[model samples]
Target: MSERTAQLSVRDGRWTLYVALMGVPVSQWPEHHFGAGVVPTPSERSRALTGLGFVFTDGATWAWEEYPEQPDDDTSPVRLLASIRVRSRDGSWS
Candidate 1:
């Protein structure tokens, strides 16, 4: 099994590295969640995760948590990414 790495850009204008396992189908990627707080855009998140050795498939599953306390029209400013499943390209769960 071979590992893949990608260069990711951070807000500081620096490059970072990420790794991932190849051959894993997008449909088989595991699910992930974000803690309460602001999160980066999908592209940024993907790149960052990829830099960390995680693979993200395009059109992967995603979900948002809704706050019932807020009005239906108003969405929570604290956007969280609930369904970004990623794994190592080397085929290791760890």
Candidate 2:
């Protein structure tokens, strides 16, 4: 997998985009249900983006860049960043 690649998942009415590194758990919560099958179809990806209030063009690939290195004291190799919601007006999320 690419260093900049991430996975998308929905749980408890919130959608999240995060990178999964080796030896790291996808999510601490068992309900997160990580490692699900990939969404290979661009149409489906577009649909998911639309449903999540993100702009996505069909047949376009979603790209991300490598994250900057963390502080020296942060020794953990595992890193994760996620956007739990994109369209919620009130910041309400599950």
Considering summed lDDT, which 10 consecutive residues are worst modelled in model 2?
85-94
Q: State the lDDT of candidate 2 residue by residue for 1-94, as single tens digits.
A: 1222235544443445543344556563112223345433445544554454344223435543333246554564433333222222232221
Q: What is the TM-score of each candidate against the true structure?
A: 0.38, 0.28
Q: Give the Cα-based TM-score of candidate 2 against the true structure.
A: 0.28
Measured by lDDT, the strongest candidate is 1
Instruction: Report, for every candidate in turn, its global Cα lDDT versus the true structure.
Output: 0.44, 0.38
Candidate 1, residues 1-93, lDDT tens digits: the string is 333333222223333223323566744444233333345466766755655457754455445443433456465343221344555645555
